[model samples]
Target: MNTLTINQKNKKNAARIAAFALLIMTIFAGLAFGMIHSNLIVMSDPALTLENLMSQSSKFTIEILAWIVIALMDFVVAVAFFYFFKTTNPQLAKLSAALRILYTLFLSVGIYHLIQIAINLDHTVLSTDIMIHLRSFDVLWSRGLIIFGLHLIVTSLLMFQTYKIPKILSALMLIAGLCYFTVHALYWIAPSIETTTQSIENLLALPMTIGELSFGIWLLVRGSRKPFLNATERFGFNA
Candidate 1:
């Protein structure tokens, strides 16, 4: 029993270090994004001139690519977390690993789209004629949100197994999930609801970002714990 506990402790410690590293990377990426592309403007202008449209589109595409990097970092943190818990809770590990794989792939897809957009942005300006019949921004944003919603749902499910967060936290995550889906639905069902969709979707950024940072900090600085050791036992190293 002592050997097993010590092994688990070692694993937890490794995990905590990894989680901290990922969190640091995530924060740095976010800061870089803010600095590099802070002035990116997304506008649906009345004239929709070719220059105006192409410039706006390019900025939007690049900003999204930056956002994808952030999401990928978050996915990495979650993945490291699963590895941390694998020995003690195989079931939760499996769930978290599954989510990590799915979202990593999904984030890759977003990066691909962002690349395609960036490539075309210079050559394909939104002509008034094109705008009259169709718009691609809505499609791109909606699709990205749907994928993100799915990722959130998966992560929340995996989190449930660990029971580390308050039940309300999970519920809030689910609510964020619903908001994601609802925004997409609105985009599809009533095109005019684009503003509403954008508003609600953007509203979630603050809360979700806070939750991820908080979780990362807790997992890193505190690590694991034992019932008998009291709060200090939180330092019990985990993989």
Candidate 2:
């Protein structure tokens, strides 16, 4: 086989790996955010939230483990995307990967705070400090998501510039990136408008979910092969 064929093979493999990682990420995040953390948190009352957290050390530990898996899988997805798109636009692809990896690093810091809470769960600690650590996770992750938005924007630009992915997919990805950027920016920029920011995010949630998840699904089915096959079918090119 020629070098092009070998590279294509590698790209296909990367797509599959990235697709699988995204799926796993969704599952773990759902369990952590939707079920575990949600049950332990009371968004309106930090003291109550702290009480719930202390009540369930074992479950909280599971949530922490889930988050750790999420972080590692995120790194895998970032590397996989880098490999998958590097040939399309080398510089932008590299920047995209780097941005995501940096976001993952920020996420790691948030997870570290959770670890601190877990380690000191049994100790008699000030409620205020515990609440601060809990809030730190939210603050830090929100900051990381701002960076995550940029990563999506860069990736979407690469998608638009290439025919390997559909134009609609690119548009959705761009919208999702904008959603993340806008919502998170409001979070820190205009704290008093928390409700408004949430509303905007809710309105834009569909695009964001469809954007990233649909592309991941596409990759799983035939993301790389379709482009190469299109060349074979329409252009009568030999592989």
Candidate 3:
């Protein structure tokens, strides 16, 4: 094969690897956020929350394990996206990777609260303190989402400028990022508007879910099908 053919093959392989990473990220995140954590932890009721954690300590531990898996997969996804899109704009790709890593760091720290809850579950004397810590998880996660939203916005902009991904996917990502930022910002800025913010969040869930899931599936299915010879051409730059 000629040099051009060799390079094309390498690009295709890279795209495939990145796509697989995204798929793994999606699966792990779904299990962590949707299945394990959401089911096991009751955010509103302190007594019920403690009882569940204490009664289902093993399951709680499994949830934490799932979260750790999610964190590891998130790092993989960040690196994969950086590698895949670095040709379009290296600086923006680096920024995107950095923001994602920062969000992961925040989530890693936040997991400590969950771990503490598991450890203190058997100690009835620590019940009150544990409840306070449980509430902290919600706050910490919201703050982490703020950073995650910024990462998504940057990633979406990069996608928009590149020919590898669809423009509609980029638009979806932008909408999801805006939803995350707006909802969380409202939650923090005006505690009195909790009901209003929650209603907005429920509406925002549709775009966020569709955007992220569709993007992941696209990456898994079609990411390696075509390679752009001139990545910056779509953005009006010389190859």
Best of the candidates, lDDT: 2
Candidate 1, after superposition: displacement of residue 206 in Å?
3.0
Query: lDDT for each of the candidates?
Result: 0.55, 0.84, 0.77
1-239 per-residue lDDT for model 1 (tens digits): 67446655655765576567567656655653464333442236434444553657655554666667666665666566665555545675666566556655655554555555455555544445434322444355455566556555654664454434455555565666566756776777787877876787688666645544555565566544422121223455442
TM-scores, all candidates, are 0.59, 0.91, 0.88
Cα deviation of 169, candidate 1, in Å: 5.5
Q: Write the per-residue lDDT of candidate 3 for residues 29-92, one digit (tens) a residue.
A: 6777687777766667667777777777888888788778878877877887777666668899
The pairs that clash in candidate 2 are: none
lDDT of 2 by residue, 1-239 (tens): 96566657777888899899988898998899989998897767867877887788889999999999999998999999888777666799899999999999999999999999888876576667777887899999999999999999998997786556788888999988988988898899999999988898888878867888888888888785654222332344433
Candidate 1 regions off by >4 Å? 1-3, 10-14, 21-38, 46-75, 87-92, 117-147, 150-154, 157-192, 224-239
Better of 1 and 3 by lDDT: 3
If ranked by TM-score, best first, what sequence of candidates would result?
2, 3, 1
